[model samples]
Target: MSNSQFSEERFQQAPVVGILRGVDHATLDRIIPIYINAGFSTIEITMNTEGATNMIQKLSEEYPQLNVGAGTVCDMDDLEEALKYGAQFIVTPITNEAIIRKCKSLNIPVFPGALTPTEIYKAWTAGATAVKVFPSSQFGIGYIKDVMAPLNKIPLLPTGGVTLENIADFFQAGVTGVGMGSSLFPKQFLKEGFEQQLFDHLKAVKSAYESVFQTA
Candidate 1:
């Protein structure tokens, strides 16, 4: 029950957030334990996905040790609905001051998506728990390293482009953590009975991350 707002603390211990998009209830319920077994301490279900709120609620109730939250939340309504459904945290692809403030008042951590330095700064200043660099693959890890040169004080969570192959590199480049999706949960891996394969893939990613960071 640490909640998603405690990401800074919990994420540092694991540093990987599983992003599950377009997954239904049964599918998510089955695959999520595999993710947890593979060492992901947090899971995010995108709001754009059907039945996302219910998924969050179910996971929160079922997986008390893991932090569950909502992603792709675009507006205040999405934010409100997500919280109502027991989302412990909120993530948006765009910086919305109103939504950020609302989340703050509710004591939930918010990670707003931003691309440019200006937007990143604005989000950070608006009390974003962290700024998620979406489509981070477009700029590459070099961009993250370069951006962190001056803004190193702010916590940056690079998503969208971070893969198992380059995840260690992103951390080396100063990203506090990463939000990974398809790379971790491929479509084929979501099929019934693919749980072991999915678990192995996630295990490999976690192993590689440990090798790179030497955290423990």
Candidate 2:
């Protein structure tokens, strides 16, 4: 599917994009199914993590229905490797026009990170699938509201600062979705056998999103 189609589908169902940073092979094998079962349609595995590419491959092969993507992609090499490993989408921590264009050329959806309005606009105009507000917690709801007031046409995803308590507020503030990490998958849930606990936590998070977005 095209980036727009993938994003639209995700928006229609679940807008939570799980970010697995520093997750190893074993941890991924344990948590991936849990994420899918919890109703997260998209996941981003940071490229800097050890065995990230391998993990991406594993997730892509094991869960072909999920949108497995590459995150923290800083350069072309990372993008190429991610695509080779079957990354369905691409996300960068910084607004790199070159990388965005490259992904665009390949028809891969890319969410490049940006902080200021200038950076966000540049990334959006450069063809980013959507602009990710990095360290969004630092900006707070006020900043997000202010930004969206003017750039509502561009889809914004708050990454870094998204918590279970504030997910609804962020969505209310006009974010297309969120990039959630520790808040959704804490270390305790990654233990040898925490499937039930993990599922319960994810269910709560999903509840929070549904309460606000009211997905059918």
Candidate no. 2 TM-score: 0.93
Per-residue error for 52 in candidate 1, Å, reads 0.9
- lDDT of the candidates, in the order given: 0.85, 0.85
Deviating ranges (above 4 Å) for candidate 2: 1-8
lDDT of 1 by residue, 1-216 (tens): 324344456667788778999888789779878888787788899999998888888888878777888999999889888988888888899999998888888779899999899999999999898899887978989999888999999999999888878888887777877888999888998999888999989988887777766763
* Candidate 2: residue 47 Cα off by (Å): 0.5
Q: List the candidate 1 regions with Cα displacement exceeding 4 Å.
A: 1-8
Give the Cα error of residue 76 in candidate 1, in Å.
0.7
Residue pairs with colliding backbones in model 2 are none
- lDDT for model 1 comes to 0.85
Q: For every model in order, what is the number of clashing pairs?
A: 0, 0
